[model samples]
Structure formats: structure tokens, C-alpha cells
Target: MKIRISWQGKEVEIESGSPGAVLVEAFGWKDPRPIAIRLGGELLDLHSPLNREGEVEPVFPEDPEALPVLRHTAAHVLAQAVKELFPEARLGIGPATEEGFYYDFEVPRPFTEEDLEAIEKKMKQIVKRCYPLRREELSKEEAERLFSERGETYKVELIREIPEDRVSVYRQGDFVDLCRGPHLPHTGMVKAFKLLSVAGAYWRGDERNPQLQRIYGTAFFDKEALKAYLERLEEAKRRDHRKLGRELELFSIEEEVGPGLILWHPKGAIVRKEIEDFWREEHLRRGYQLVYTPHIALRDLWKVSGHLDFYAENMFAPMEIDERAYQLKPMNCPFHILIYKSRKRSYREFPIRYCELGTVYRYERSGVLHGLLRVRGFTQDDAHIFCREDQLEEEIFRVLDLVVYFLSVFGFEEYQIYLSTRPEKYVGSEEIWEKAEGALAAALEKKGLSYEIDPGEGVFYGPKIDLKIRDVLGRFWQCSTIQVDFNIPERFDLSYIGPDNRPHRPIMIHRALLGSLERFFGVLIEHYAGAFPVWLAPVQAVVLTVADRHLPFAEEVQRELSRAGIRAELDARGERLGFKIREAQVKKIPYMVIIGDKEVEGRRLTVRTRKGENLELGLEEFCARVRREIAEKIVF
Candidate 1:
């Protein structure tokens, strides 16, 4: 049969009986391997037979589809190695995640560092053995019996939970797993693999379920790619925000203070204040009206907004006040919606943009919390745009432009944008969903930007456009989102008078350029390795005196820099020049103005950059250079 395969924009036709068979043959060609196969509108398995003509796209290794396959196969290799070594370990779920793959196992003891090393060694051996992977279909009863005969109770339990009568199992050598898979053809296909770390995870991700030891691992298609990834991981570790936060005395999460709660020290607060100032200026420039909302609102407000019913799980528990219940705001959408409903609006005033650095709270799972990246209380750089249907595309384009501009300022040039369409359980009407999704797509296309369409990956309320910024280590973080919500206006009964003087529901566009201030700050720390740009740096410059005689000059220079709006301080402590320089470098200060008797007498200051470059300049000239760099927001 003839089949058409299209990817990105290219298309080709091949004759084959099955998708996998066709790919196996096509792999011999110089074409990129498909990560997924789309037969008609359905995502079909690579192993599924193609009996008729249809469109197919090959998802290559760089495609998102390949990540899941690589991660899933890595999980299988992990399981096989575990069974070979421990023999008594009970398997639970092994699935691929956005970052990597993880497998949960109930073992007699938690996996030690040495145990992980051994397991990794065995996995390498399995990869070297080049065992062929074969899939077999069996009735649910037979699958359960087969697993039961092998004393794999977890596999039997998993099979029992399956609603289908038939199940698929993949076997390689002596190990077999009950999985619906399109795994690699053989173990040797896993070229670059590494076991990340071991952690405790609940079976099926349910807290009430028994906790199992989870082994996390990541794999790549080639050895060189793997080495690069490993190096990136090392760099990421060195740039970890948590480590930097502690070292720089920026923030703290105390055991007594509570988990998922951050205590911003003076240094951290300075950074935060600078960020807020920049945000306010940018929003004002972009025609956004800044608004402040309360941290807590009546419980009924959320109920009216539908968040209490639909988003209750993520919300913190309600508290009683004067025999009435109140809830901590989990999101700023409801508050912003209330602001729009406060007064009647005309069509001329339809596109009302309200922006806020709103602090919200959510009850995140304990095990999932990671420093500032995942927290309970965080501030969202949120904005809502209320506009007519005709203005939707223009507004989306504006938002997209703003996101690109803001991210570029932070040195985030590479981004992975995803436009998500309506899900099966979405609230909006089909026509509305279509119109909103089309507007987002049109905006992306108009800007000549490429984005992936995530069908059925949208929010329950409406479709959304998500932007993931690629960090220095090449990892993507979901930092920006622009969602079109038709349900909120309807549920809240929001309306604005149209050109015809008829009341019409305003199209609400919810957006967060930097999803959360706390999370974004963490990403920023890692992205720049704690050495912020002069414009955003908490302490942009430090004046270090070489000796007691230079202390007066250092203080004078510090005052001069401070007057020029640079965050400069004098290091007048009883320490040697080398110690002071070392201290400034450790703090990642962008610039250090070193003053000694020789330089002070000559009316010059020795300049040292964070990257270890040194220069000597007149005091007045140095100030001019610093001012220009700060004004320009130079990144180094």
C-alpha cells in the first residue's frame, strides 16, 4: 500500500504493509526516523499495520515524540537490569516523563549509590548484548496468569486493572513487562544512557498508595549526544539556584518555617525589588494598567468563578471567618475578572489590560517541591486582556511579541512554543474553541514563528499557547502562557457594550509572561550562573580597598557609584586585597573597583570584571562606562 509521510512540511510516499515495517525500510534511507506515526486523525502505534493510504509523519530524535520513546525504553532497560541483579524486586509503573524516564520498584532495601552503579553496569551489559525485543498479545486472564506464575504480583495487579480483555507484553531474554509499547527493536539501540538518581515515589502517583523506590534515568540516541548531555547536567548542578541561594545568602527554606515556603533574605529581596521595578516599567510601556488584589477572598467568589469546583484540588483548604468560609487565592484570574465586572465597559474600552504581580498559594505535593522552582506560595506576573472577538488575534500577537521581547532581554533566544487546542472535557463551545485556537495559530504564523500543536493538551476552560524557554543547559522551562478563556466571562456574567450598543461578553485572554516570579528567578539564577546583568544585579559593583589608607578612597568611589544609580558597596573590613577580591568573585558581582594608595594618588581605580578581566581607568571615565553598560542592559 502507498502511504504519505509528512514532517514539519516535507512529504513522501512509501509502499508498506505496516507502519513499523515501512519505517524499518525507510530507516535504510537517509531520512530522519519518525518519532510517532499519525494514521488519519488517530496516533497509531508504529507496529500497527497500514492497510490503506493515509498521511503519516515521522517524529525524529530531536522531536518531542522521541523523548518519550527514549525514556520509556530506558525504563525497560532499568527494569531488566534490576531483575537480573536483585531478582526479588517487585516492579510497579515505569513510564517516560518530559525530562526523562523513571521506574518504581518495591525492593527489600532502598537502592544505595553502589547499588545504582551496579544496576547501571548491568544495564550497559544488556545494551551490549543486543537482545531482540519481541511483543506478544495475550488475553487479560492469560497475562495475569503468566505474571502470577512468575511471582510478579505487581504485574498481575496492573493487568487486572486494565479495562481491555487483551494486553500486550514485551519480552527480551528472560525478562518481560506488561506494556502497551512501540519500543526500540533491540536493547543495543540504547546507545547513551545514565541512571540519574533514586527517590521514593508512590505507586501510580497516589499519595495513599504504597511508596516505591523510583530510579530516574535519561538516554540519548548517540554517545556524543549523551556526553554533551552529561556535561550540561554538570553545568546545571554548578548553577543550581538552591546552592547559589544559600551561598549568596539570598533565600532560605527552614524546617521550622515549613516546606514550599521561601524566606527571602535582604539580598534576595533586593533582587526581587529590582525585578518588580523592571516589570512595572515594562507593563506601563505596554499599555497595561497595574492593579492590586487581596491575598484572600470570599469562598463564594471562587465558586462563582468556577475555580472552586474545577480547580479545588490545587487550592488551599478554606478557612472560616465570621461563620463564612474564605479561601487563599490559588490564582489571580478570579480577582481580575471581578475587577472587570466592577463597572460597565463600552466597546471602545473593550480591550482593558489589567496586570498584577499577584501572590497566590497552592497545595503542591510534598515530594514534588524543589526549592524555588516548585513552591506553594509564589507571585505570578499575570495579566488579563478583555477584548472583542475581532481583536483576539491582534491581542494574541501582541502578547507573543511581548513574551519574545522580554525573554530575549534575559538571554533566552531559543524557545519551544506550543499551541494547545481544546481537550475532550473542555468547557467552551466547539465553535468558540475553533475560533480561539485559530486566532492563536494565525498570530504565530503571522510572526513567522514555528510552534507545535498539542491537540487535547489545553486547559479545561479553553485553548492556550505555552512558551518554554531553553536555558543555558538546553533544558526547557514552561515560563510563559497565553490562554483564551470563554468560560470565565460566561460564568462570571462579564459583559461590555458593543459598537451597536448591545451587551456582548468580552473575550478574556489570560496570560503570564513569567509564570511565577519565584520560579523565574530560580531559572534566571541558573541561566546566568548567579552573575546577573548590571541592570538586574542586586549588587552591581563592589569597591575593595587594598589597605587602610585606601579605605577613604574606596568609600568615596562607592558613594560616587551609588549616586550614579549603581548598586555599589565598599568592602572596608580588616581583610587583605586578595581576600576581598575573592569575596566579590564568590558573590558573583559583575564589577569590582579596587582602590589602593597608588591608584588613589593617581585619581584612578583598578577595575576587575567577574570573568577575571582587569583594567585601570580614571574614576570619572569608569563611572561613565558603568552607567552606559547598565543603561544598555549588556549581557556578558
Candidate 2:
């Protein structure tokens, strides 16, 4: 049989499971292990017969595109293992994640560590059989019947949602699953895999849906690679922000307060204040005009903004006040638009930039509430720019520049940018959508920024550019977005008088450098492992007393540091120096200014850094160094 595949700018004839390389070789990775192959953006197993191939790229273990495929196959193996142990377990959607993969099942009870071990043993047995995965495509009606006969109601429900007449399912041995094409060649290919943990997840991520137990796991081509990944997982656990927040007395979510509502302790508040001060200063310097809006607005405002129609599910329920319905603010964009319409704008005021650190509320499900990362009430660094069509691209470029600058300030140098286009349900005309998308693309191109096109992932109102920053743990966190909208202006009848005194609709560009303060703060905690840089650290330095004899000196030193604009604290407790230093280390203080007898007599302070570097400097010199580092926003 002949296979039509593109290789080196020419068509080539090869059979299934053909040997391919050079994609990894080009990236300086010499991994020769083949897991799957990518043909025209779609992944296919090594043995899957190609009907029509454009270009096939072999996926190696070291390839960036291989983990999702491997982990997805591991999830199927996990499901098969679970089915062997509990034949009544009903399956849910199992999609691969950025880190690994997880599959949900409606089990009678949650799986335990013992269950995981038993499942792993069963998986090994299945792998030993070397079952070749067979893909079958049939009518959707037949697929529903097949799953319904097996009592897999969840699968039947999913099949009903598919708009296609035909659906595909994979079968390995006696196990069958409703899924799309492209998985590993056989069961034996799932070699090095481990079930990490189990958690409760709602089916379809909807709180109203049935609660299912999700089993999380990771897989790799080899054992050594799996070991390394497990090690990284351990590091990630150590850096978990929830644990650090409690241990450091930074923040908490109390039962008295609602879930996803953060109550910051003194230390956390200090850090937040510093972040706010810096943000305000930067925005003011960058030609931004700070504005404030009410916490609640009339329900009619949301209706006019289309939030009531398109975003009602996410918004909190409205309350009746003074015989009028009032809604809690979910977004600051509509208010900013109101501010624009407050005054009759002219061509001279084409680009009206309004910035605000606005606190907004949303009805987040309890099941999805995560520490500070996913919160119901959080402050967004939201800004809006109403500009003429000619100024749209340039304004977008400026926003991109600010986004990069803000992320870099927090030591995030790597980012994954995605340009999301129109979704299925959206406002605005096709011409306006195309123009808005074009402006964003032009700005990104002019800035020489590479991005992926996320099809049908934009908000209902507009196309947007989402910027996700990579933390130290190699995890990506969404922190910035730049969206362009023309429909909102039309909805509000926003117009600016042009050179000919004609009413021209002004294009609105919505931007947020730090998507939300709580989530960004959480990312920062994990990125630095709670050891903040001197600039952002709540306690920049702590004065440690060597003995009761050094109380006077320590007090004087801390006062001096505080007077010099450093956030310093004095630990004058009658405890051993080692104990005090250890406490300071636990708090992750950036500096430990130790005052002892010899140093007191010498009139010098022995400053030990968080990294354990000892520097003996005079009080004046130490203050100067701290000020320099703080002013320069030095990250270490």
C-alpha cells in the first residue's frame, strides 16, 4: 500500500509504523523513542493507517508534543485497570493536562492508596498481554447504544452532544472507550507510569453535574524520566502556595468568611500593599488615569452590557434594593465604558485610557475553589482604552509592551502567548470580528512576538490575546490578556466626533497586565517558594539579638533600618541566637541583621542573607545596599 506523506519538501511512500526522525534532532534532543506521530496537527499512533497524510512528524519522548499523548494513553490504561478491579465503575471524560492526565469515574467510593497499587498491578498484567489498540468508527446512534448497553450513561450523555453523525471508539482487549483518534500503538507502550493521587471532580466541570472521582497520573517512555518527573512533583508540593501561606501566616480563607474569599494577615497585607504601590506608580508613569467604580451597579447596566445574557452563569445573583435590582460587579469594563460615555469625546481624545485595580465578584462553585488561585472575589488590574480605528494597533502594541514589563518585574521571563479568535456564540458582525482580530495580529507581529492561534476560545464579545507566564516549576499561569472589542461600543452607542464632525464608533481595547491580584500573588509564592525578593518581601530584614546584652543595639539597628524605608522587625526575645535565626529562616526573611558584642563594639552590622552569605557592613552602608536593591527591583 502507498502512503502519501510529505518529507523534506517531497512526497514519500512508506508503510505504517515507518521510522521517522530529525524533528528531535533539529531541537538538539537525541531521543530515538517513538510514541506517536503528528499528521497535520492531529496525532496518530505509529500503526494507525493514514487515509491522507500531509506531513508526518515522529513524536519522541523528549519532544514537547509527546507528554500529552503519552499521558492520555496512560489515562486509558488507568481506566482499564479500574474496570478490572471495579467492573461497575462508570467512566467520564479523561483529557490530558499540561502537567499530566486525569480520568473521572462514578465509583461507589473514593479510591485509596491501596486501590492505586492494586490498579497498577493489574495494569502491568494488561501490558504484558501486548494488546493492539483497535479504533472503530460507527454511527453516533450505535455508539450510544453500545455504551448504554454497558450501563455507561455518562458516555451516552457525551455522545448525544456530538454534532457529528459518526463517532470513534478505541478498543484494547475487552475494554472499549469513547474517544477520538490518536493514542499509543498498543497497551505495552504504556511502560513507565504512576498514579499520583485521587480527587473529587464534577462531571463536565459543572457543579450541578454528578460528582466523580478523578485519578491523576503521569507517564513517560522510560523509568529514569518518570523518576525525574516524580522528583519535580515533590518539589512542586514543597512549593505549594496554600501550605506556605498558612506556615508563613500570610493569608487564610476562614469559614466565617465565604470560600474563595481571602483574608490577608498583616504580613500578606504588607506585601499586597507594596504590589499595589508599585502598580499604581507604574500605571501613572505610563500615561494611565486611575479611576474608581462602585462595587454594585444597576441590573439594567449589565443587561445593556450583555453580561446578563452571555455571562449570567458566572455572575452572582442580583439582589433587590429600594425596589430595584442591583447586581454585584463581575467586570470593570462596562463601568469604564460608562465613564467614556459620561463626556462627549472628540478626535483629540481618541485614546482615553482608564485604569483601575477593581475588585469584582463571581459565583464560583465550591468544588472549584482553590486557595488564592481560583477565588470568587478578587481585584483585577483592569484597564480600558477607547481609541479610533487608526490608533487601535498602536495602542495594542503599547499594552503588550506594558505586559512584558510587568511580568519581567516579577522575574517571569518566559511566557506562552495565545491569540484567541471568535467563538461559536459571540456578538459583533463578521467584518468587525475580522478587523479586531487583524489589529491584534498586526500588533503582535510588529512586536515580533510569536503566538499560537487558539480557535474559538475568545470571550463572547471579542477576540483576545492571552499571555501565560511560566513559573520556576515549569508551570504556566495565565496572568495577562488584551482583548479588542467593537460590539461594546455599538451596544453603548459610544462615538467620538471625528475630523469631519461625524459620529465614529471608538474601538475598545480591554487589558489586564496582572489578571487578578490573588492568583498572581499565589503564583509568586510558588515561583519563589515563599522566599520573596527583597523588594517585594514583607519583612525585608529582621534584627536578631545575640543576647540580652544586644537588645539596645538590635533595637537601634531595626529602628535605623525602618527609618531608612526598610520594612524591618526586631526579634529581641530572650532565646538562643540559633533559635532566633532558624525562626527567621522559616519565615523566609530576606535579611537577618545580627548584632553581637564584637560587632556592637566595631559599630558594624553583620548581615546574613537568605542564601547564607555573610556581609559585614556599617549600618549606613547596609541601608544604602538595601535601598539600591529595592529601588532597582532586583530579584534574587
Best by TM-score: 2
Candidate 1, 313-425: lDDT as tens digits: 89999999999999999989888988888888999985899999999999988888999999999999999999999999999999999998888878899999999998989
Q: Write the residue-wise lDDT of candidate 2 on 305-359 in tens digits.
A: 8888888999999999999999999999899999888988999976789999999
Poorest stretch of ten by lDDT in candidate 2? 19-28
Stretches of candidate 2 off by over 4 Å are: 1-41, 46-63, 424-426, 429-432
RMSD of each predicted structure: 3.8, 3.7
Clashing pairs in 1: 34-58, 34-59, 35-59
Q: Please name the candidate that would achieve the greatest lDDT relative to the true structure.
A: 2
Off by over 4 Å in 1: 1-71
lDDT by candidate, in order shown: 0.86, 0.88
